[model samples]
Target: MAASSLFAALDKDGDGKVSASELRGCMAAALGEEEAAAIVAAADADGDGLLDRDEFLRLAREADQEADEDGRWRCLRVAFAMYADATAVEGEGAGQHITPASLQRMLSRLGSQEPGLDECRAMICRFDLDGDGVLSFDEFRVMMHDGLM
Candidate 1:
């Protein structure tokens, strides 16, 4: 979900592939013109224009590698939904509540590993924007769309 959300945001054109302008636009929308350009330069692996979906997804996956399975799932689902909603609409938008089914699935995905749960909870708290004890669609969208930490 987080991966999808982040990926969709990176794929600014909604054409399913990231372009230099789209990546640049998302960065600008998330950060500002100055910072966005810096980020694009950093993330633009081949510098051929923009980050392809695979490259962006790879970086996002790497960032989530340390998160708990539950937290990671929650993050991913919310991110996916938010990306859908953001791209579904246009311009800036507000947040929305995540579905109960999504929550249940997220929780169920949490493995029996206690260490994983502890680390995931910590990661969720650090990244959760709504602070409703879980990540919200809006929060994930903002994080992805704006690329703001």
Candidate 2:
């Protein structure tokens, strides 16, 4: 969903503003409590401990731009670490990239139940910039930042 829609959804109280508590609940899965608080502090222009439409949209746009720049690499590093823990081989250097099989395994572990092999391959194909049938760190970064995966 677009950031605007997400912001509206998060404004459960219908006050046309999002409080830190609301943001925490909506983003807790991807961001830590401290991280959310920091974001709120940085974006709350009026120091109201809340984000109105303009503030939220500005923050979202800035975040999107940052992700397009260096933030994607940070996200890729975290994803790579998680994937490596789940699919690392003893001597195959599997941690260097995300193979189709490894991606499937990671998805399964992430509660996908039983994602098909073809589905995993298609996902890789969508983001495999080098056409190597796998996702390199750069490819993964692009996929994440572009919201293609």
Candidate 3:
């Protein structure tokens, strides 16, 4: 997953920690209110009802690993779902891949200085292992997990 972007979404108050409410709001659609609460409860190592970056990362990585072992792509689905939510456009095809324009917008939203289209294209080229000129979910997962972008 795009860790920083996910964290930014969860840290709704921008205080660098994810409170239970923030996590619940961010994860509710995928995990439901109760499941999200349970996740926070299990992951909050200090019983603070909040997840610091380290704690959140550990929880996410553990979840990812478990899903991988189970042959499920939960993390990738969540990452792509966030991307779609952030970049959806009217009349667009069902977005199964990340286009350069959308990626540029996503990066800018995540606080990167506005990246030029060329820069976004270059990033796609760098990670488009299939040579499709766009980033598939698998490519995105590799980029997120390996820091390839």
Best by TM-score: 2
Q: Put down candidate 1 lDDT per residue, 15-39, tens digits, no spaces.
A: 7667656665666556765665565
What is the overall TM-score of model 2 with all chains considered together? 0.47
Worst 10-residue stretch by lDDT in candidate 1?
A: 83-92
Q: What residue runs in model 3 are displaced by over 4 Å at the alpha carbon?
A: 1-72, 84-93
Clashing pairs in model 2, backbone N/Cα/C closer than 3 A? none
Ranking by lDDT: 2, 3, 1
Quality of model 2 by C-alpha lDDT: 0.83
Candidate 3, 46-124: lDDT as tens digits: 8888888988889888978887866646756776655542344646545777888888778888898998999988988
TM-score of 1: 0.34
Question: Candidate 1 — what's its lDDT?
Answer: 0.56
